[model samples]
Target: MDFYQADPTLENYWRGVILFGRNVASYKFALAHALYEVDKSGSDLVTLEELAVPFSRHLCQHLLHAPKQITSRGSQFLDTCVQFNNGELTQDTLTETTIRLGFNNVIDAFHNVNAGEIEKRFFLDERKTHKGIRITDNFYQLSERQQYQNLAFETNARWNLVEQAWAMGVSRNLVAIEFDEQEKLLFSHVNTRRVNITSCRDSLNGYQKGRCFYCFKPISLVPADTELADVDHFIPWKARDEVANINGVWNLVLSCQCCNRGKAGKSSHLPSRKLLQRLHIRNEYFIQSKLPLHETIVNQTGTQPAQRIDFLESNWARAKNNILFHIWEPKAEGEATF
Candidate 1:
């Protein structure tokens, strides 16, 4: 699926960075939040010190909840942020440390996805000539959009999901994750208690490129909207007992109300083989993101791509054999989007 050509909007490019960009650590998200902060001030040219304030602030705020921000060990910048959070470091020291160590990678990698820079350059790296980044017109246009506020919410939501997955160390254990259909959220069990991680719709909308999983239509992120997105189980959650880890993020996709539970919506039905293939592709997006979802899916399915496809196919065959389900394809079809 062409990520840009499917939507080809400023928001789509921004979503590509937030939702699909590689994150060994969450520096991309912090830089993204800081960009939004400075974008509000209408400042085209933001010095390193000006950028470090919100950049360090967001990291500090997230660190209060999640102790581990990076996948690997030992980040001097994160250590400084932690010290600041623990009242051991001054604000000036934190800002200076952030300016020195924080932007080393994230500034150049902010617009990157799948190891390539996105067509829309949100900000230009100006550290060589000027000790700061220059906000591009694309970013200003994004900020001026009506749904700009929601983009920030979506970014935070994605960040929460990734960090929570990392913090839980899903690779080590077979996580006991439960989905609340009522709240449309995912909860992970820790020490016999469940903790809410993030909203399903907000976390998933970007992967789907803000389109319905089945019909490829725009799904609303606004709560008050009539067509707010629905978190649909790609393999049908009703078969949870029969299928292992059926409610995992691998099986979840964001759908519009009409395609989810309308007159022709898919309910307790097997999706078509094409949709099954699409599910594989969608799962690849999660895998490439390297979020905890990747580990969880690999734990449930398989590590190798072929093995993963075999897992999906095997499940589909089993579900088709036992349950009497009419194969479901969206009545209102649109272009294919992963």
Candidate 2:
């Protein structure tokens, strides 16, 4: 049977849960319930404080049941989270805690849960000290890693440019292009005449069909889009100066004009590289395995001989891992409020 056939009405329910659970107050309760379900086989045995550690434990356990390819990519994230928890909690080690909880088995514990119905949740304590500091530190570490990667790409591109210059025995004059507040080309050596911002905006809208790449929000009504769809550096420009050219396609992305304005010249608030790697693995597994299973279950149930319980179990395990990585987690406060 296809995974979705087991639970037909899951996608809509999951989307709702994800939307509502992002609220700080609701998130704590939702996370507590998830933790209790994993730990005590019911949602009645755990207190709020006990929920925190087990949430991490459940994440690790679910990861263990994922496909080998996915699990391989998750090693870095697991080690990083363990280290972070160890250092942060100090007295209690994550390794000891995970082992004590008897979650070392690679069993498919989440097979019964509807994969599409699971939503990412978080816990927040208003009175907790160092909360902001921890969140900020995590964001900074990931940002630095992304910046480093961008710089590396820039260096390679600069080297290529130098090679081209040497072969030509002369170089064309470097053009300095500057965009105005409206994203119109205000200054350019190639064309001294000012480029119309409205034209650029219309061009971008046509390209992206008026949708923001990050949040998938419609940008047609956004006032900033009237000037131009903010051309964003996928790999930030500040840290990658070598290839920070005025015309690099790989570095650019279509962003919501509002988000572009707010996030101008700013880095993204991504999770650690370790965490990102894990998320990448989970994402791939979902696309390769679980998504297919969901589609198959929805369309071809009882038509295929290979549709065994074991097959479904494996696929569900893969989906469960994807959910645990929090790949669909909403933005934190003040990040993507457009």
Candidate 3:
């Protein structure tokens, strides 16, 4: 079935794959023990090529269906496996070899069960745009230009201030906005203004509408709850300082705490040629015309206008796919077995 059309139960299966993949280090040690036994019996070398299938099946069955809590050792082994198989882990030690083998097993297993086919199913219809344009293009075009850069920077700075103000409210404390000698706000004071924490949470919640843009998890904020969901910079803030980078609403997204944490400060979005092509944001004129107004509506209302979501989702999905493929290369490396 197409990944998007997969039953929720089947969806959970993929989640299990990701979670298991992340913890492949633990599986590596176990596989190592098995390999040692096989080798000790005067058998041939049990490389990844020899053991991929059974090991993958073993992991899928034991790791996913079993109810036992994963031990720390197991977690480490699985993590190592994923890193090694994806070539992110170096082969300086026996542990690394085992981990790489375990990862190979997982990839083999995923293929055996047609996991890749499922993912392709969901992404099959994802559209492609221009190859030259991207988040940086939009940011530079908007910021370097005479008309909009200052406005963009000022707007982002303002939001930074607003975010701090909202944080104070969550802490149930008063705070003051700190300003430089020139009267420009630098930071917020401790325990000064009675921040409208509810309003701030409401604003972010409304923007996300409860769904994490990346993981698709629901992200709701309870009234008076201190832990607010994070607002992610679709393109990280550190990448540039232009007004377009600061003010573009298309650059913001609602993310669950976990996915947001994973994506923090990551600038390289994807490595695959096809995926990169999809992420390129060509048509500078379109970006210039649309991004500033999108920012204005978001800043004023703390929510995106509906019309913008359609365009933004398409653009964001391409960018997100690029990042996911880069970071989760193991998930993308193997071919579908079926």
Candidate 4:
């Protein structure tokens, strides 16, 4: 769609990574959560405080969706934040109380000063002169919060920032350009599992009868050295997540080493229609077992099986909208003839 040539502020403002309404992803959910940090006193202008809210949240909570957290950016940051706290909560696996203690440091990372702006790193350098400006804009040549302006809506004839954050949609081609290499790594790592991917090996193997998720190749339930049962994020973790845990069992699947290697980090990839159907059936099996995962799916979507299917279909709508006819896997490698 030549996203590079399109207007950054207006053209695709309504299209980026939206999380809540229909095609919402966790990344978009992070952005929406940030909009709530704004001050509501009369003025519609955004402040540095508001801008930092989303950045901090993304930096701290991105991997919360994943099954394990040992290697996540938020995990590392949280550990650093609490290295000094002396208590029983630090016994192993931090308690929620320990996590809450670091809340102050997270917010403090975004300084409250005109001199240094940390939030600007995630925004486009280019400015939109027409629609005011965001406090996060450059101190020298400033840009508008135009990227987020479109998300705004009037309540009692006044624009509400929080509401806009919730309703703002995302572009199919949206990319995070502001974060540099080290920071990028902090926000993302596909090989990064929330917990050991192997933890799901037994559960998924039993569910699929020891067949790979995409290829349906026979996998050894007890492969020596765990080579045959490579845990895969059904939706590649690299595609949309900015270093959060995309390793949830809902997204995780057992795959043959070949298929997992071929599908390496293709973030934009979506499963083919056939695979999507397979996934639906597999999930139904999980539900029938009445396991904890079934409850997890319901908690995630707040709906029954019928609505859950609808959500996945809708998520794929944007996922498949890439310029390449099929950015999904098997574009180069031959898919299994299931």
Candidate 5:
């Protein structure tokens, strides 16, 4: 479904889905970023080599699911990315290898953009014809438009959503696993007994005082069985594959069914800075409990309380900077005015 279809909001349109359909002319954030970030040389064209690097990097960072690679290739690629970021490897060298993994998919994705059914008049490929893959001047121009930017944002939001689901699955090593039919081993020995999302009602709700994280509404736990508090990841666990221990107590919080469902649909929102602050206090409450969760907090951050605060703050900042993740605007959701 289209991002707008799922969440009819200005922010949803601004941060679009990975829409690529036959003659649908839909928008894609990856394509827009790749086009705009590429060389602005006199000609409206750049070689696949030029575009390939940025495309690979962008996809790697923004990829929602495991890129569907052979055994260990995905983790290998991630390790290389870390090395590259840490200056152990050069960008050019990393790009050379990484392009092979997803460049072809990028080409097909661009094809989807051109052939999709959103604004045919703004189709990127219509402006130019070239033997090799190259972005056109029209693409650059279109990407700058307000409508284009909104769609781009929507596309990114979808990508973020997929990435979140992917992380949740991967943290449990459930990637590519088929439970009903054939069992596809993604990580290693599948533990049929150990569940990643264990029952957190007893712990999380008690810690939260049975209040929803987002709405702060009182949640029912007993025979009421209505609006039960859900143990939700405070940080959303979108990039758990990249960041370890996201499933830890430090990131766990309670949300009522309504707020939980609302947040579940909001693929593009980060809790505001103030909410992050609140989460810190909440986690600090956990530390005072002196339970296993207390150790979790100490281990994730440090022995020093100030360091723990710094850890939470820096992590939220990291999230904001890393994905350009924005705070949710409940007011922004509605019929598309543009």
Candidate 6:
């Protein structure tokens, strides 16, 4: 489904931008975090300097832990952020640099995803008329959402995952990030040590676009939500002995608790061919996003689309023959919406 057509809600539109949008640099996520921080003041109109404070601060904070924020070889704006983080540059200098170079493309490109603009505009670019952006009613309503904090954490998680991917490089040996199902994180093995990358739930939720993988209902990473999201193995993980790369990102998905473990949960059963096809579509989003998971999926599955499909089907056939005796289907489902 067209991402915006799936749920048209403000929350989904925000997720579409964060999850599916292109990521040549981490500026968009930093800008998104800055928006949330600024929104707390309840100001509809924000000057470039006011927005620059949080925006530069966020990029600086993240840079301290993970150095690579952009996919390119270097960025002058990011270099300025690093200097601020290192105490080599003053906060005033950082703010001025942010205003001059930070908003160059993100301000205009924030709402775009899947080569289209989302239906809702969270902020209006008043920079041409004024010196800043005007927060739209859509943004205020989004700020008031019950899942607002979850959105903030999701952006951080996506940023962390992308940078980690860039730092780890695309080699199979260095970039083999494994999921710790118990801790619900994706971690990589560096030399002899293991480094946890980011929350698996927060990272995958974007590709799923905040909806259940099976029934297509809204889901959340927030601890307080009654119907919390679950990190699920699309093909049952229990049959690992029969399937290669069973725990690969290509096989994992974020599912609603009900569709994951409730009365209609797939449990150890194999999903129907229809759901397998749905899984294929979801995995393609990972490929299209060109994030770290894109390389991981390609290495585990195949380099081409047809080969990836064959990989899933071959494993499904093997698991069907070995472990699962039942074909599980969701009790309730809507049109496929990934």
* Most accurate candidate by TM-score: 6
lDDT of 1 by residue, 180-235 (tens): 78888877778787889888788777777777899987777888888788898998
**How do the residues 216-269 of candidate 6 rate in per-residue lDDT, one tens digit apiece?**
777888877786788988888788899877778888988888888877687778
Measured with C-alpha atoms, the lDDT of residue 41 in candidate 2 is 32
Candidate rank order under lDDT = 6, 1, 5, 4, 3, 2
Better of 3 and 6 by TM-score: 6
Would you give me the overall lDDT of model 1?
A: 0.82
Clashes of 2: 1
lDDT of each: 0.82, 0.31, 0.34, 0.39, 0.48, 0.83
- Please count the clashing residue pairs in each candidate, in the order shown: 0, 1, 22, 15, 21, 0
By the lDDT metric, which is better: model 2 or model 4? 4
Question: Could you give candidate 3's per-residue lDDT for residues 94-194 as a string of tens digits?
Answer: 24344344454333343112233333111111112321111222222323433221222222222333334333442344333222212212333444543
**Residue pairs in steric clash, candidate 1?**
none
Top-down TM-score ranking: 6, 1, 5, 4, 3, 2
TM-score of 3: 0.25
User: Better model by lDDT, 1 or 3?
Assistant: 1
Candidate 2: clashing pairs of residues? 2-297
Model 5 per-residue lDDT tens digits across residues 34-67: 6656555545556555665766566556432434
* Candidate number with greatest lDDT: 6
On TM-score, the stronger of 2 and 6 is: 6
Tens digit of per-residue lDDT, candidate 2, span 1-338: 12223222222122223222222111222232343243323332233245446545444443342212121234543563445544664424554453343222211122113333242212223213521101222222323431222222222222222222222222243322233434532222233553221222332232222345454455452343353346664333433433223233212345655555563312342223332232222222222222221122223222333443333333334433443322222233222211
lDDT of 6: 0.83
Q: Estimate each model's TM-score.
A: 0.84, 0.23, 0.25, 0.36, 0.38, 0.88
What does candidate 4's lDDT look like per residue over 82-187, in tens digits? 4423232342334333333423332332221222332223232112342222433231111133223222211100111112222221122111111122221111
